[model samples]
Target: MWQPLKEKIKIHWPLLALAGVSALSVGMVVALLETVGVLNLAPADSAIVESELAPEAPSAVLGLADRPPAQRTEALSLIAQQQDNQEGHRARYLLATDLLSQGRGGSALTVLDGLEQDYEALAPYVLLKRAQAQTAAGQPEAAQQTWQTLAEQYAQHPAAAEALYTLGQSDESTWEQLIANFPAHPRSVEVAAKQLPVATGAKQMALLRLLVNYGLHQSEYGTWLDQFVSEYGSLLTPEDWQAAGFGYWETQRYGKAGSAYAKAPASPLSRYRAGRGAQLDGQRKAAIAAYRQLAQAFPDAPETATGLLKLADLLPQPEAIKVLDQVMARFPNQAATALGKRADRLDALQSPTSAQQARDAVLSQYSQSEAAAELRFRQAQQQAKAGHYESALSWAQQLLKDNSTHQLAPEVGFLAGKWALQLEQPEVAQRAFERVIGQHPESYFAWRSAVYLGWDVGDFDGVRSLDPQIVLPDQRTPPPAGSDTLKELYLLGQDQDAWTQWQNEFRDRESPSVAEQFTDGLMRIGVGDTLDGIFMVSNLAWREQPQARQEYLALQADPAYWQAMYPFPYEQLIETWSRQRQLNPLLVTALIRQESRFVADIESVAGALGLMQVMPGTADWIEAQIGQTGYDLTQPADNVELGTWYLDYTHREYDNNALFAVASYNAGPGNVADWIQRGGFTDADDFVRQIPFAETQGYVEAVFGGYWNYLRLYNPAIAAKVERLAATQPNS
Candidate 1:
């Protein structure tokens, strides 16, 4: 009876169910509303990394001993103190010297007066400056007394002659004796010469040459010559005297019509025009001899090469070839065009089969010539074409070693790497590839090196030891993820497309946060890359938002923030730490990316461990100082802390200059410092370009590049604003 009733109700429910369902839904909603409230949620752990507060462990400490902050600070402070006094004195002297150099002699006098009595040598120099200042200020009596003292005390030095010259009015009788004693001096001769009548055109022209021999670039000699020529126009041959005078004064031989009006025949200009005419007229031998004489006599003269080239053009094939050989041997860059012309002429005269024979003859006779080097390179290329892999590799290697800084070094390094790989020598090949990257990071060879190193070695199956499975992070091989979310978010910032691409690719398969980190690290240390993706993204992002722009400006103001963001590899940090006290943040970032992909515990084939890949010696040293004897080197935070601290020390040691400090960190302080002194590094970039160590050079560049990328992507606004500011400058 119940079953029949339920069936009837279910069948009739459509009509009744609509009303019942509405009431039940209302009741359920009311019940659920009382139990729940609105929920606002953020990430479980949302905190931005502060560059300043971040721990920077000495990179070496990852494997060795670590120093506690108190002890490390104490040690570094003592070291700094040890050199402070000397550094201070040097700084003061430089300041004073700068003031003097800028023509603020009175200010320099005040600084010199403040010097301590202990600065004996410097005191004398300051006194000299004071005397010069007095003279400049028109206090002749005061200046005279100062000069009298300088002449008495510093007689052996050149100061005495200078002082005596300045105070010659003190006594006429004394001045006469002084002139007699210093008769060989120019001032004495000048004094004697002033008593005579002024020189005429011929006499003036002759006098100008005498001044030229003594090394002066003044045009006074030229002025006198012109006056003489104008006054005695009818007495002398205008062209002869004018040409002679031009010859003497036109040392640079940049012959404008009026430049050589006041010199004698012995001048560089006279020799240049005469030699040029002779060579053009086909007096080959005479021209060659004349050019040799001119060039040998006046090595710094601009006409030197002009004469030589003219001479070479006029000579017969045999003599011309000899002259060309000499030119190539001595001045390769200057003679490149001539050498190529000669090579082309020879090639035109010979068939393909005989070209080699002709080149060989040239090489055999002129082994040291630029012509020979080019010929040899061509021969090597031929060998490569013919599949003589070993021969080609050998030749390329010789060229690379012999002319390491040559213009063709990149090409040679690339070829060596390629051929070495073909010959089944991975180590040699890697070295060759490294050479290209190290010496010419901006070249096509560097790009190729990155590609070859980053390619999936596994894809090229038959190539042994390449292991395409092992991919390096820096290479832009396979494209990065094409995630639309990342694209939109990145572009919402500054939208520097090129930099975005680089950042996306550089981050590659790494975690997004880590990738962002890598980008931010590079921008602070001036690690500029035209194609760096991280830099582009950050630049754009900063451009898009005011808040992000502020963060970037803050980062730029704090160098340490940039320092912590560095991705130093184990080997490089260790090397840098050994020499300097601080690490360049860009370099650190690049190394970290390359060595560990930001993984702290990663080990290498050589038994190196932790973030910096420290060996046992490194670990022990770090352990001893920090008293964290049992600390694990594999821990990420620990390794980063230890590495950054050591880097800080390097910076402290070198007074925060990344160049000297970084080089010392890579090569050792003593070594880098010696190189600095030896290399005479007046310009920073020039010094970087001239780094002799291939590994060290590449290490510096990549690390700095990585750091720059980090800052550019994350803190875009500062760099963006910098661009604006640069544009506003008058010179910009």
Candidate 2:
């Protein structure tokens, strides 16, 4: 049996901390991901694997490699016995992988014999594996010859880099060849990692530049950039400055990014970002200069229009008003936003007549703009607060008519439904709720609407114990981008190879296509990068380009996109604990996602740790109550056990009302108790609105929102219901 290994990649680069970086491949093992090169394999001892290995419908012979290793072992071996077809070719290659993993090199060699002649998609990898088999079989000379053969024959391929890396183990010269030929490959990344600590001067800077170019600059990039600036600033080029600035910006080093961008090439985007970065970093003087330069140099550029708007923030009142006037006159697309700002400034100066003119112009000229929608929403909220539901309903209705696809449409529509109910109009309220469910099923409001309309999904009050059934996808979806080889490697559970191939191919870090970005997100999720993966997928709504946004809208219609956004990382543990506590597993999953984005060992700044982000003090207290000790907080099993126990306690305190229980989890029971006494509201929804703590309110909604998403995406019955609602016309 080829058991899975539990070992870290030799050189770990903390994946893009802001968003792009992620630990790699999640199917059958926790393998090295992102910029790290996977150089060696270790024997496994029953390591974790996800559901992609579940049996699939039969058809393609190549897909047999996707089945679970143990389950498919016999089938693959028997298939390997046939030597004439592509199925046999793939079977032999796969069988060799298990053999190599188990250190049965002689057997692996026997199966891999002549595989390069038959396996065209992975011929280079076939050769590379053969070298490993030779070494494992104690035939060092054979391995050396095989490595040299692979490196020479497929010098242009990614596998050639691996061959060079293996050969470089004894001969120091092959490292340079690997670096020269496959600079973006993870193995080349390893070469830089090996040489960086000892190398300095031009050599050190070269290595850093190499790493940065490969998008290998992860969490420590900011520190590296700082060193490059302080010690080797003279060596920097416009491109170098741009790379450093990008790394600094992504890692939240705003101050450094601002300075670097100022020195970078004079692109419209760079100039605008320099000012924005400076503004964010609190350098008002630098920001003003940068923005002023942008206004003068690229007056026609869209980024400059945005830059001028930002510039208004730092300018004096009179100067800001002048800037806004200029923006409104010059940029029609940005005119509404600029006019709204102008109105606010006029109002501040007590010029009501002028302010009213600007406000009217916004509605008359740019009715569909975001600023107009905001204005309408503010009025609706004001009217509702004043208990004039008729006026509120009118404003909400108008806003939806004008800005149906606005970011705030879901909230506004839901508010309209509530206001209609307040006005004693049951039909209007039901219509509003249905429209929200139909048009914005992905929104938090949709879940609230579903509950109000009496969907079977358990409500906040009773969701604690419902055992909703869910069905996991049997296999990974074929990625929308990447070569056929990359897709095959990924879907077949060859995660390590797929990760390396992906990193090598994906060089569009700054701007990527919808397909590329979606593919990137899928790869991240496949490898257990819950945070990076979800962020990449969910933020597609913010796409600004027209075509990209259209593509995103189309992508939204796919169930796989929603599924990728809400994945099941620890299903078994969640189920066991939820059953023990008589709680909903989906609720637990949602809570974990909100708490830590399902990063098993993540720790919060407040000393909360692990999947549930349980406080160490809370863990200690729970241990005292449960009569258990010597548990690690970073481990998923212990953390979920303790976290679920605490969750159960909170649910009991709140009579299993999930809203109050989830609130208590974040805000503490004392604050929740205080709220119940102090809160003066009509019902649970009203209570949520009146919650004093903004963070707590957001946290509560986020958890429940997450719960709703998980339920809809995973539970077939709910998924069908939501899909039906989404497909309906607004009124229908």
TM values, all candidates = 0.34, 0.88
Q: lDDT tens string, model 2, 300-391? A: 99898899999998988789999998998898888999999999989989999999999888888899998999999999999988999999
Q: Model 2, which residues run further than 4 Å from truth?
A: 1-68, 71-111, 136-139, 215-219, 730-732
Candidate 1 per-residue lDDT, tens place, 3-75, comes to 1111111110122211211233423332322222111111212231111110121111111112222222222
Best lDDT goes to which candidate? 2
> What are the runs in model 1 whose C-alpha is more than 4 Å off?
1-124, 132-140, 151-156, 160-251, 254-312, 316-355, 361-369, 379-395, 401-407, 418-429, 436-732
lDDT accuracy of residue 168 in candidate 2: 93
